[model samples]
Target: MSGISIVGVGNMARALAARALAGGNAVEIIGRDRVKAEELAGTLDGVTVGTAGAAPAGDIVILAAPYAGAAEVVREYGDALRGRIIVDITNPVAPDLQGLVVPDDSSGAQEIAGLAPEGAHVVKAFNTVFSHVLAAGPAEGRPLDVFVAGDDAQAKARVSAFVAGMGLRPWDIGGLAMARALENVALVELGLMNHSVKHTDFSLGITLLH
Candidate 1:
């Protein structure tokens, strides 16, 4: 992708912005707190902070905010996102960071799609990997895999290519409906383990293999 705009300034967003910078992608961060966005951007090269209402126009718009906050931000940026590809990196993890609290039939990514501008396409991505790993990865010069899913095939393609640009593998898991499974509580078990276990590196599991 030509450019990326991340809509948060938290750890995940920081890591993502860093990856985009390391990969040489032009990146802008739209933070709910403008000062925080500017502060974060100051620490990173090739990135600038943006106001909540004026997210930069980019080929990729990534929602790095918490799932609980995503819908509202989508609504806030509805007009600015027309004809854009939005990538959702939020997991609906409860405050306890132990489990997901989203509805059974829906996912944060899907919810974002509902709140997005009429023509904007939303894709699920990045939540499956931990932020620290994203920043410290590529031990073997090969970034870890990144999985993406969206209702629009072209949107998925756009996001998948962006993921690939970050030195990672990108796998398309079909339409946006798959995001529910992608962000399921069960999917985070390994990530939790990765944090609890010091030596073991954990990745999200896909059970399509026999």
Candidate 2:
């Protein structure tokens, strides 16, 4: 089991914390609002709470904040995150929801990596899966597929192990550069939800034939 510190008290953070605890990993919830963080931690058994800007107790730190605030969170953590694995789960979608906020040449994860402290390994995961779907477990009887992208192979492997522990499949789709594709995939998912599916119960996955 791995030590997981999530730097947010939002839905995604709560969902990830619940799954992490279920997988026997240590979970810590940190947020700018101490009361909110404690409240979220109270809902999850065995989970701990911490304040923002504190030294995260876990080696793997997940930035579960929205795309607009993820960079600020990284900057706030600064040198404290050095040598640790930082997970970027933001999609960088525009407020209008019609396009991406990030430049076409770069992704939200890559931008966060640029702001992160030296020695910190930033991996992009969980952006494709919705918070509700993630909290509710597998969709349509198949384990959810988590697309992982990172420059560090070991970091990706560690994250994959964590995902597998939670009964999910981890797809290592090349290096951190692939995070652009993952974000685009999430954009497409959002588009489908708004226009085609008209609901949020479904998630993106790969079906294999043997």
Candidate 3:
């Protein structure tokens, strides 16, 4: 499995690191707060904390932050991130955090794609899954489905492998434009979360009725 570079030190970033390491990938985390980054790294063995400006160059960089944070990190690391697979986990929800903040035809992933290097490929995944749900992979290690939307076929393939390493199956939803639907799906999922009685996360899975 290819190693992963995570660009934040929050819950989502930690979750990605845990899942990636558990999936047999080398993980490096970078962010603004060195102390917090180091703390999170200590929680997970085999994970290391590196400088934000000097984060490891990897096959994939998971932007595990909000859309605002994503933009900031991409802008700062625009040059270093060239030719790498960038996974945009940002969902631009309103202040209420219940609905999307983007207008029709544009999305968080699309916005991040704009700031990226010409050849840098960006995709959307893991936005819909609750952090806790992903923290614990499905029992028996069956792959959960991660719907991916991106423009570059090669980048998508790399991300697909990374997703699989985390014990999840990656489903291609077509070009980067497809991320709009993916984000909306997350909003719908959030609505469902509010009604849940407990911390048990409800995940979406496609099943054939036949």
Each model's backbone clash number: 0, 0, 0
Where is model 1 more than 4 Å wrong at Cα? 95-99, 140-143, 185-187, 190-201, 205-210
Q: Could you tell me which 10 consecutive residues in candidate 1 have the lowest summed lDDT?
A: 199-208
In angstroms, the error of model 2 at 71 is: 0.7
Comparing 1 and 3 on lDDT, the stronger one: 3
Per-residue lDDT tens digits for candidate 2, residues 152-171, read 99999999999999988999
Local distance difference test, per candidate?
0.80, 0.92, 0.84
- Per residue, candidate 3 scores C-alpha lDDT tens digits across 32-132 of 89999999999999998878876355768999987898888999886888878899998898877576787788899998999998778999988878787
Most accurate candidate by lDDT: 2
Kindly indicate the candidate among 1 and 2 with the higher TM-score. 2
Q: Tell me how many residue pairs clash in candidate 2.
A: 0
| TM per candidate | 0.87, 0.97, 0.92
* C-alpha positional error of residue 123 in candidate 3 after TM-score superposition, expressed in Å: 1.0
RMSD of each: 3.0, 0.9, 1.9
